[model samples]
Target: MRTQALGGRPRQPRGGVPFMLLLAVLVSPAALAQGASRGARLFAQRCGTCHSVGEGDRVGPDLHGVLERRDEAWLTRFLESPGALIDAGDPVATALLKQFNGIRMPDQPLSEEERAGLYTFFRECTAKGKGSCKPSPTQKPGTDATPEEVALGRRLFEGTEALAQGGPSCLGCHDVRGTGVAGGGTLGPNLTFTFARHGDRGLTPLLAKLDTPLMRELYAKAPLTEEEQYALKAYLADASRDGSRPRKDRDFFFLGVVGLLAALGFIGLVWGPRGTDPRAH
Candidate 1:
């Protein structure tokens, strides 16, 4: 007679695997795909600023076939806190820092599940072949953009047209040459050559997230709409290209000087000379 288990089922003949262990081994392919999808989105949003998969080096090195080069445990530790690895003088991490012009990778705090997903994503990319995985293509506002789109971009940049999301206009913070007589605000850096400096890859992610401290604070609630982003990007690209040509900035300067003098003259007429009363004279 077979021995009965607590649930009235026959016991295993010898050493059998437990039910919980069997269930743990049975993950569906759909579940794995979902994790990989999440990882891809996260990478595009966060890592794409500094790194790419198969594309050549950006701010950081290309991560294609990174798994084959570094062990998973070491990669995990490095991802958790690169600065720590650098501080501890890990040979590989130190070499990476030196190779990348000493720009230390920022710590990426990811939960185990998220990390596992990233590993899956990386493995999938590696399996495809060298340089097989590429960043998702972003819409570039290049010379191909129509004149109308460029005009809309100018309007949006100069705040002549309101942003759909009611976010602060670019002119309020950034200065772009040829915008107007006064130009743009001085609080932020001049954006005349921004496109030339960052190019499409860098600018796309920056615009998508606006992840800088000040920008995040300002645009956390009021984000730019897709149309607004495109228009603004187009305008900036145009501005960068046009920066090479000579502009009539001297005329604007003279006009501002004349305006200032007129304002002073009007003030004098209204208030008269200081320390002298019209009634006394």
Candidate 2:
């Protein structure tokens, strides 16, 4: 048969057309899935720290249904150079900067292929519904905080729960919105927007090393556990979403009273009793 086919275009392979068709049908879906997967990874690495696809705004606007809100062409231009658009005073860009509390969505420098992938990922997220889109493995799950995490974080930050390693409590020098009247001290900066301002990329490293002049001394011997850091980060992230606000004044008088009481109790412990001295004859 092969000898005969050599004279007549090799008579084609039997069932060749059907086999090729089958291969295309089997491979196409996998190729599409792979492309979308790649897109998701790119989105997480480049855009996810500051923007959420469905879960509400982070440091920037939520990108769910973004293509629906803004045309792909416009989005392309904006994503490529957000600062340029803002500088040119594009009305929408200006409004976005204002709406998100003056935090600019940083420009994402992407080639055409990467931009296409991100666009694809955003579309997939919109189709999946709010909070349904699972990020690629490369992404951190910090885009949204669970209620449990926020509550635990709150307790940890307020010193109501003791830290594992006896590190300095955040409440000793910082304040948050719901920390209450006597809750937080004011020696450090208010952390209302610290997470929002720094996001995971900037904040995670800072927390891990505890390298600041004061933090090094304070937490050097008693570093925060990973769990503790995550919990506190969750709490601060929740507060950051609340945006900037005035810190409530701490009840310093109560603190002074407590300190005085503690001092007297220590003296009593060292001496014989509350009314007695160690040197009594």
Candidate 3:
């Protein structure tokens, strides 16, 4: 998008060196370490069977962009016990079962921290995707958030300002914009990591659910419009993917350190060989 001139107007001069919006490609070393720590191991042990980052699907669907497709609560529920949702007439789960030849997904029990780490794995892939998304030179980065998009999203999230309808903003149930309560209201589960969990597929369904029986039963049918959905989605998408990239020169230092320590500990155990206590000798 061309930079807006003064008075909030977009002015593109002929041959005015039309600039491409380049974000601060600053991914901190800490974020990479955090991503690879527990999440990397958890993904390998739990999700590695059916999924690979760039590889296609196996028994089940490919999970590469799952975080972008579904939201956190949906993923948590599905993972905790797939049968509950599949049997209880959940459309998405039903579709999944059919897609996978009606084979049931075994229930998985992941600690909150473990699930959070998996979220990190999903986020890393999405971050790489964002970096690689190439919009046509003529087209604005509409789907992806620019700084201006983020500002718009933030405003839409907080209800201090009003939207088109009498309907309130998203700040009602979920926490966003890093304000109010850290996790927001209790009627709904915390949405802090939702973007990392469901991603696009998950967020897309919520727009339809704005008028669903569940919403009507719960919130007296407080419907969200298409614009509201777009704005809120933008807000969530922008906020959720925030992390720093590790320095390219130095990679896997933490893992190397951990591996070295583990090797030393193993050597110590073997230092006392079978039937021979070195201290005794």
Candidate 4:
């Protein structure tokens, strides 16, 4: 009698493998390629601010041949929690921190799948040799923006035009010079020189993600649209061009002061102290 398996089926040979496992193995390369594409986008959106795959260095070290220099396990651990490794005194992590001017790499909350995708991306880049896989540079509006776009940006910054995503306007938190007589809000830092400070490489990812603590919280749900980002960047570039110069709106200021005095006089006339009439005296 033949040996039987469950459900009255004949038992397979000892060397036989499961069909699902075989199918997964066959399809893994395609899956990895897809994951690598996603990883490239993630790198542009997040990692491009500091680290570059092929470029020499930014705020962090170059990542070319990073996979060859470190094993996948170590890379995964470091990527997941760089701070933890640094605190625990891992020699490599400590050396990297010291090498990069003590700028600690933040802990990334990436899933296992995402991590694998990044590994695949790194591996593919390594295969392509050095300087072959640089992230595409972000296009800044700078001197290339049309006058209409700059005007739209000003309107957007001043809250005259509504943001498409229903997010709060820039005027609520930050101030740029030449906005108006009253300027903008004070909750955030002055942004008159933001473009000068960060330039295109730094500002691109910042505007794309808004990853700072306060901004992340504020825009966690309501992010800026691409058009809004473009417009705002254009306005900021224009502002930064003349940021160091003195305000040129003398007439506007004079008008504002005059208007304020006129309003005060009207208020005083309406609610001034009562005086005896000359006729009664």
Candidate 5:
């Protein structure tokens, strides 16, 4: 004769809770690795152009031990809205702006999960030390360009250094601030802030394909070399930094004035003048 429970089921094993806890401990590293992997991809897509982990600062400060330096709450808030923090005059944000030459870090659009993943990646990089946080192949280089390399890039863009394939220089169609007396051409969009606008993710592809209507025809036979591409990227990055500072864009100013006058004229034609009442009695 044996005693039996009402439902005739045996009780769960006594060690089950401990076993599950052990399993969780074993699985955590893999989970972290997965998160870090996702973080690496997101970083390359979003932050790799301007920031580095252990390799020292680029456009932004090196983030080797960012977690150690800043608390999680602050990092989360700052990442969510760097511009707002700067505008609010947070000391750290203001100092970072000054440190990075007034190039404001744009606010990132990241879900909570994505932000967690980035944190995991930052932790992984910090644990691994310098040179361990390698950028993926898609990340363009020359972010750590030397001054000489930047100068060479400027020369190339301005046609001071002739292209080996005889392709037209970048200056013919584009403009940048601080180019000498002649300045740059106006055929293409002003390139003063091109790097900031596009980042490496946008820029690398554009350069590699040269697929814009005009660029396609011009560089179809004269493709840029890898070295040339890197050089030009360095120059554009430098110019982008300058564009962050206050400066005048003559073309933009003129166009703005024209637009303002046109708007004023249209308003006048539609409603008479500023103080005129159009109410029907």
Candidate 6:
């Protein structure tokens, strides 16, 4: 356990192993801090051109909702050797190769810690439900709703149609924003956050499924109109996470200049009357 130190004097730092372990433990957090879970910035800088979790669907298939969808064991193996996975006929890996137009995602040799951090980034993305990091209000439909469209979209989502009609409204099966129905009969993922989760493109396709062979027995019979689509899109957009960054964080010095002008006007209003009254009143 001893090593020669300074003038070749014997030293037992940690009795050797304990010191090494302690140093390892001490340096671990700093290493993690420098890793990707700090945010997607590094991953994006180094990897984003070919990948995304926002479901934007660029050169790669949308990585947005993939954590639960892809197997971690498979992810680790594939990261180590993507070509092997493609040749082995791993369904997802094979599909990814074909979907990206046969362009192979290069094998990036990641340390175990780096791979773990990337996994963390994946989980964080899904955790941030449509973007609100702050404790904001429930995301609501805005872009998809014109003043006219909100009511219609809400009605269809909530299933308020007369009960005598037999067929329950859209909420009977698919869930959308503002549907008060509880446990929502689990044929689809819960919509309490769907709108916020899937904006327009992602949500639209599923709505169209209402009449598909699979959903026809349950969802497709109910046709949502074009206008209904717009409203629903609006609802989803509004219910979305706070995608907008804070205004104060942007440019408030301009606001300060304007506020100074308003203060001058207020001073004029108060002083002008008193000073003028002495002579002109």
Query: Which candidate tops lDDT?
Result: 5
**Candidate 4 residue lDDT tens string, 178-201:** 885598755454666666655644
Candidate number of the best TM-score:
5
Q: Write one digit per residue (lDDT tens) for candidate 2, span 1-281.
A: 21111121112244345433532453344344444366776777777778777778889888889999999888988988999999999999999999999988777578999888787877878887888665533234344567887788788788778888888778876766668467566545456555664555445545655654445678889887766676777777677665323332233223333443343354443355635764456
Q: By lDDT, is 4 or 5 better?
A: 5
Q: After superposition, how far is residue 84 of candidate 1 from its true place, in Å?
A: 49
lDDT of each: 0.65, 0.64, 0.53, 0.67, 0.69, 0.50
Comparison by TM-score, 4 against 6, better one? 4
lDDT of 1 by residue, 23-62 (tens): 2232222234343366675676678789889877988999
* Model 3: how far residue 35 lies from native, Å: 7.9
The pairs that clash in candidate 1 are: none
Q: Write the per-residue lDDT of candidate 5 for residues 12-84, one digit (tens) a residue.
A: 2453454335434533443444333678878876898899888789999998899999999999999999999
State candidate 4's TM-score: 0.40
The C-alpha RMSD of each candidate to the native structure, in angstroms, is: 26.5, 26.7, 23.8, 25.9, 25.7, 24.0
Candidate 1 vs candidate 5: the TM-score winner is: 5
Pairs of colliding residues, candidate 2? none
Worst ten in a row by lDDT for model 4: 1-10
Q: Against the true structure, what is each candidate's TM-score?
A: 0.40, 0.40, 0.35, 0.40, 0.42, 0.34
By summed lDDT, the worst window of 10 consecutive residues in model 6 runs over 1-10
Cα lDDT for residue 4, model 2?
Answer: 19
